[model samples]
Target: MQSVVEQFKQTYGRLNARSLGLLAELYTDDVLFQDPFRRLEGLGALTRYFAELYAHVETCSFTFEDEVVQSQQAVLLWTMSLRHPRLNGGQPVVVPGSTHVRFRHKIYFHRDYFDAGAMLYEHLPLIGMIVRFVKERV
Candidate 1:
């Protein structure tokens, strides 16, 4: 049997607006998912969140870079290649991020770490300039 982390990676790689059903195979009913943007509890809320996200993106894909697993917990490093019509002239933006997940059979806790500025704020027109300036100054 494949480990939960492997299943997660496979499922996540195929995820999109149409593949939102796959999330149920990877997470428990009451899973907790947290990222820089928001914290979601329950599979229903997570599905809605992904639906909204995928609806806006032209394309979004992940490249798994590395992982460290111990028992029921895993830390996965990944790069997300994203394209949105409103961001970066619809060109791909690569964002490096990581996910820490805990599972028994299906994941119940998943937290993602990534720079909000790099993913969203820095891609906006006016805000992007200000964010970039602030980042440069800091």
Candidate 2:
């Protein structure tokens, strides 16, 4: 179990299109994964979701900062560096987030918490200005 968490950290930190095939090793067949904008169930759906996600992606990577593992659950703090054609004119975008994962032999549930405004809304043009203005005032 300890090894599984370590493996997940390593694999996830290096995640890319090529490493995506290895999801089966770290997640169960009926895995549940969710983030700010998407919720996916089952490994197959998760795979497809990732495929579409990286379709227009230029580069994506993660850096794991901290983790707490207990029983069958683990919480991970990470910062993601992402570059996509549609966002920020393909420049790198850094978003800090945390993941909560529960596993048996493999991870069965995973959830990520992060600011959508930082990831998307604040990256737009006109809307970005408005979003940032509101955020600063709040």
True lDDT of residue 1, candidate 2: 40
The per-model lDDT (C-alpha) reads 0.94, 0.88
Displacement of the residue 54 alpha carbon in candidate 1, Å: 0.7
lDDT by residue for model 1 over 78-100, one digit each (tens)?
99999999998889989999999
What does candidate 1 score on TM? 0.97
Show the lowest summed lDDT stretch of 10 residues, model 1.
Answer: 8-17
Off by over 4 Å in 1: none
Candidate that would win on lDDT: 1
Output candidate 1 Cα RMSD. 0.7
Please provide, for model 2 over 3-80, each residue's C-alpha lDDT reduced to its tens digit, 9 standing for 90 to 100.
778878877777777678888989999999999989999999998888887777778888899999999899999999
